[model samples]
Target: MSDKLTPEKRSWNMSRIKGMDTKIEVEVRKYLFSKGYRFRKNDKRYPGKPDIVLPKYHVAIFVHGCFWHRHEGCKDATTPKTRTEFWLEKFDKNVKNDQIKQEKLKEMGWKVIVIWECELKKDFQRIMDRLEQEFKK
Candidate 1:
């Protein structure tokens, strides 16, 4: 096995992270709120506990981090030079889980909106438009 961050250090690093209410989450929430859209925050009752939930619109939003969610072509999604196998495995599992969650949410009749961290810079407006479309549907 490759050696980089020790198990203890990795645990600490991961532990310090927050799954929800992150910077991107806050920004998206604020933007949606500014547009007069109101919703729930991380309702565990839902399949993925979406970042923002518009139950009336049957829409669930997930603000995904590029690094964690492994967004393709994302600058923030660089793999570590060390412990390559471990990091790749972790990212692969994350991607798989995301797919499962989206499928489950869709099966429940919820329209899923995935906002990637990189997309936030270049496609924020497009994301909003898609969300609006979902609301209209």
Candidate 2:
């Protein structure tokens, strides 16, 4: 755990970590857009600022990074080698927040759709198909 990161480098790397508009986000959005599906990106009015919002279908899509959202059994979601306890607490809180947001959105009559980063990587076609079906319904 002796790895040293200068403040500038650490800040730069941390800054690159966005809550949205990630690689998977761009890919999913591109595919959906190509399929003629329109959505609002990161709608502010939504509880979680959903990555993609289709008011027409009353649906919201959240694309969660495996590590950030703690996708179980996902290799990409391994806890940090350092600050293990802190990361555990952070991940747990993130999951709790997600659940709360989903419940609130549902109560408000919105269909919530969550796509894991690993799912997108493992089977982009299947994920896209699911989204299409969801959007259709």
Model 1 agreement with the true structure over 1-137: per-residue lDDT tens digits: 36477889988997989988998799889988998888999989888788999887889999999999998987899898777899899999999989999999999988998988888877888887876777886
Error of 2 at 97 (Å): 0.7
110 in model 2: Cα distance from truth in Å? 0.9
Relative to the unseen true structure, what is the C-alpha lDDT of residue 73 in candidate 2, on a scale of 0 to 100? 89
Worst 10 residues of 2 by lDDT: 1-10
What TM-score, computed on C-alpha atoms, does each candidate reach? 0.84, 0.90
What local lDDT score does residue 21 receive in model 1, on the 0 to 100 scale? 92
Tens-place lDDT per residue, model 2, 31-50, is 98897888999999989889
lDDT of 1 at 14: 79
lDDT of 1: 0.88
Best by lDDT: 2
| Candidate 1 local Cα displacement, residue 89, angstroms | 1.0
Candidate 1, which segments miss by more than 4 Å at Cα? 1-15
After TM-score superposition, what is the CA distance of residue 45 in candidate 2 from its true location, in Å?
0.5
